[model samples]
Target: MSTKTPTEDDILRPIKNTTSKWFVLFGIAGLAFGLFLIGWAYQLMYGLEVTGLSDWGSGGGVTWGLYIGAFIWWVGIAHGGIILSAAVRLLGMERYMPVARMAELLTIGGLSAAGFYIIVHMGRPDRMVTSVLGHYHITVHNSPLVWDVTVITAYFVLTATYLGLTLRYDISRMREDLPSHFSPVYSALTYGYTEEEDEVIERMVWWVAAAIIIMAPLLLHGGVIPWLFALLPTYPAWFGGIQGPVFLSIALTSAISGVIIISAAFTRAYNWDHIITEDVFRGLLLWLGFFCLMFVWFQLQRIITGSFFAGISGTYATQAMLSSVIYVGALAAVMAVLIFIFAQALRPSLFTKTRALVAAVFVLGATLFEKTFFVVEGFQTVEFSIYEGVPGPYFPSLIEMSSVLGTIGMVTIIFLLVSKVVPVVELHAVEHLQEGHEPEQEAPQEVEA
Candidate 1:
């Protein structure tokens, strides 16, 4: 056996191994997906009538609050993967190489959930046929909602394609071991080639990079989020022109952190220590650090600008974000303290396992904070009337909560399914490292006397 330590790339390529673990993960996701289907079917059978929503009160449909909120939140979380993959490809950032494939997979998995959430949110889901076929009853010029649909759909396709091609690239390298039955699926996924697929893969990769550069910023416009904010007559915090973009930044920050958590969890679950190398952890930590800073900046900006807008309507919006326990202000404070502590404890070195674990926890907390705020704050921004000239709290009812949880389950299921089929990391990109490519590792090992 060779005694030399392998390069990061060398270990990332999947070995021809299978265990019952994939089934277990898939089973959990499937259960969640099934729950979502139950909720979905219930909504379909009863229509929006089963929900606590009323046009007379607040348009209290499940559509605007939890379903749409989660839709935008998940979409925000997804942008990190898109940005990371596209940025690395464009800038030739080799450090990002280890995680690029997984990042792309994250984009596909997250966005697929976002799409499903949108469909589930439709009050008249049956009318989705008409909407997709190009009928529109609502429109606002330069609406984030419209742009969101366009860009998100594009991303779903582009990221899925990119991931599929990359998976194909990995499978092609393992052609010797791949069974005959799986060959066609592998070839089709890879765009139908064996040897010279690099050129095709490289070109597609750059195209996605370009798309990411353009669409990432556009994707941030709070998309469906601003639409949700617009539902409120009095709430200005979520309605401001800057709110959408600000939320976008928060989304990217959270999504990246979530990816780090997911990566760590999967590695631990599979005991694939070699594949998820220190380099990958290091790269993620660096980004998580930057994310911490950006999140703080965004929160401060919202607070400062929001404070100045302290008239009745503006003040309400500001208070909604700043005072709501579950929403904006508290989470921001927690993130600030946690991130500072994490940054101090974390070193730039990827080899430090204890520090890496701490960093992962920070990223997860910060991202979850950002997402919780997106939903809870958005809910507060909309004003509601209680019985007979009284104002009411914006709590989600039972059905709404169920629906939201169901969509989450759906997202988990889709990603779980994909993981079973595709190599989540790029195999070929790392395989070259094992072929006597790295200088230091090329030397023969001496036997003990």
Candidate 2:
């Protein structure tokens, strides 16, 4: 076993260091994002028509397609990420502390991407100001779309507060160690700092964590998000009571898979094998598997309901999904990953961090594919009788597909930029580890007399 002790230097390396490799990666990410902007500009200049999206259940096209699918997918990943971080704090899951800040950052990045999809899907950027904000007072009570916007706003504020509160503690203590160029940024975040406030900050952060936990089900992921689809009685494929729990499961699954990917990448880049550790990967794999099982169970619940109990339109939707090769294959891929994760859990010898990372990547893609299919099929089979053949061979246009790469690049840029300014791992995490590694004082032996 490795015996290297944890230190502030380990956490601060990203901030203090500079390298050509980091710049190269940043350039590549920028290029990817820039390319997407060009695609987005093309869409904006001509129209969303360029995306092959059209009116609902007409001309074999969908009003909602990859854009909406990707939005939900990003939101799930974002919401799930905060939930993971909150769990680490509130539940005292110290093993996860090393990566909790990374998850928090992921939440910020994911939400930005999700929000970008909203703007891209809107076609006209002005509509947000004119349509949503202009009519907010009237639509707040009746519109699911408004509810989504409201909660996302609240979520963003809450996450920023959570992250900022934690950073004050880290940044103030490490001021001398951090780069001088970012002093203004650090000063603003840590404004009004005092050594005594650490205790108060701790309590305040705990309560914020509690608030996030409450919101996860009652307001955000399991509430308004699902309501967006469930409240639409006209769309039989979308309406269901179980959407809240189903979405919650997907959020957790997507979030865990995302965390795994982020954690693994950082671990490799920073030589954090001893820090992030094989044990951490194994533990994370088990959590991912649990959530995956929940996702599968929830899906099965919906599938059976749609297939049998959900009337004509819903049954047709379910049957259509069941018959689709793409849908079936995606579900099978999720199941295979789920089984592999569980097998690794049961037989410890079979587990490798590499396999866990691979599982994470596979599951992330599988969840996205499933979510995208869910979005498309809902429209495809909306009307069982009259519009039976309306939605056919639905696929995202090149521009639509490019949004995915753009959002990913966007998230990468977020992480890359943030790592330069702040320690990606929390200062508290390193200190906690430092304390844990302190050699114990042995009891004095009595003289034999």
Candidate 3:
């Protein structure tokens, strides 16, 4: 077994030469992000008044449904990255080593996207500062939002610190001859630093990994999604107890897929030799397959539960999911995810570059749509006394759409910019291979290279 490590020169190559496709991608991302900013500014100046939201129905133009749905999706992606980082570090799995840094980057990026959406979703964005800085005693009855915001912030800080420290260490390894600061302040931030060696970094990685593995899931499943869905009495048929678990599964799946797709795109655009091999993709597919199994079972539970008690609205929301138009979209999306996974698992070789990219995009879209059903569809059915017999229809206006696009555009821009400056794959993986676990080789000899 040989890990063909990329040299410092190879790592530095992308940074030095940004004149080609890199610039183009960044330019597009930037322009889209600028558009988002302008749109958001327009919304802010005119208020939700410029949009379709009415004072009549306790409405802002933006639907909390879409924002919350996307928030969960992004949170899932973030958790997936955290899990990837943690798994690699904990197990010392050399195969996952290449993607550790990549995974961490996704975590930060996805979380940032979710956080921004939270702000835009709010009718009162100005209170965000007060929400963060103001103090209150923690109690079960108190605002879960307070606690959620706190935990999420802490998780972000920890992950960012871990990546920053590791990146600095990677820099030192790639250019040991160069002068760099290791003052007391910097070392403290690096969490009690030592020599910038592969093994040392791995051990440091172990600590960060353990922390992420523990914290991210807690913040996401235990904290965020559950906090939203738990309050509702009228959970749709599709949303069984399995929603949280399934949410976790899809989150990890999408997060990993996003990382893989982004990394592959980076390789193609930059022609970086450090791009992940087929074995990595195969591993990703395997993980995707596992998620597929869970998702399939989750769907089956919904359908069976719904079928068993047809027309039963109060107790079982499953019936609603099976028969509803919204669930039609949700079910189709779920089926697409399953078919994609089955295609990946049954005859793995068929997933070529183009197919894998297609599959990845499909799965992400399906998962996002599924989330839409989970959030928006159920909210419409809640038998609140105030609503009487009339049902709510969540039709997001252009203002909301613009906000959503802006957030996504911002996230894409951030990712593109980061890919240019940061090493997308972990340098430590290469170093570990060079340390005699696997003999080094050139491209012509590698499988799935």
Q: Largest lDDT belongs to which candidate?
A: 2
Off by over 4 Å in 3: 1-5, 49-63, 138-141, 176-201, 234-240, 314-316, 324-326, 435-449
Model 1, residue 103: distance off in Å is: 1.3
- The sequence of per-residue lDDT tens digits that candidate 2 reaches over residues 306-401 is 877677778878888888887788788789999998787788898887888888888888878887888887776654435645665678998888
* TM-score, model 1 to reference: 0.81
TM-score between candidate 3 and the true structure? 0.84
Write model 1 residue lDDT over 1-449, tens digit each, in one string: 23343443233223344457756866776776677677668878887556544332344322245566566667776776778777777998765565676677677767877777667666666545665535444532454444556667777887777676566666666666555666667667655565776887779878867877776765443455555564444555565566566666666666666667667766676554555555666667666667666667776777777688456666666766666665554455546544654655463433464555655555545555455556555544544535344233445556666655565666566656555555565664455334534556567889899
Once model 1 is optimally superposed onto the true structure by TM-score, how far is the C-alpha of residue 24 displaced, in angstroms? 2.7
Q: What is the C-alpha lDDT of each candidate?
A: 0.61, 0.86, 0.65
Minimal lDDT window, size 10, model 3 = 54-63
Backbone clash total for model 2 is 0
- lDDT for each residue of candidate 3 in 44-63, tens digit (9 for 90 to 100): 87775554443323442223
Which parts of model 2 are misplaced by more than 4 Å? 56-58, 383-389
lDDT of 2: 0.86
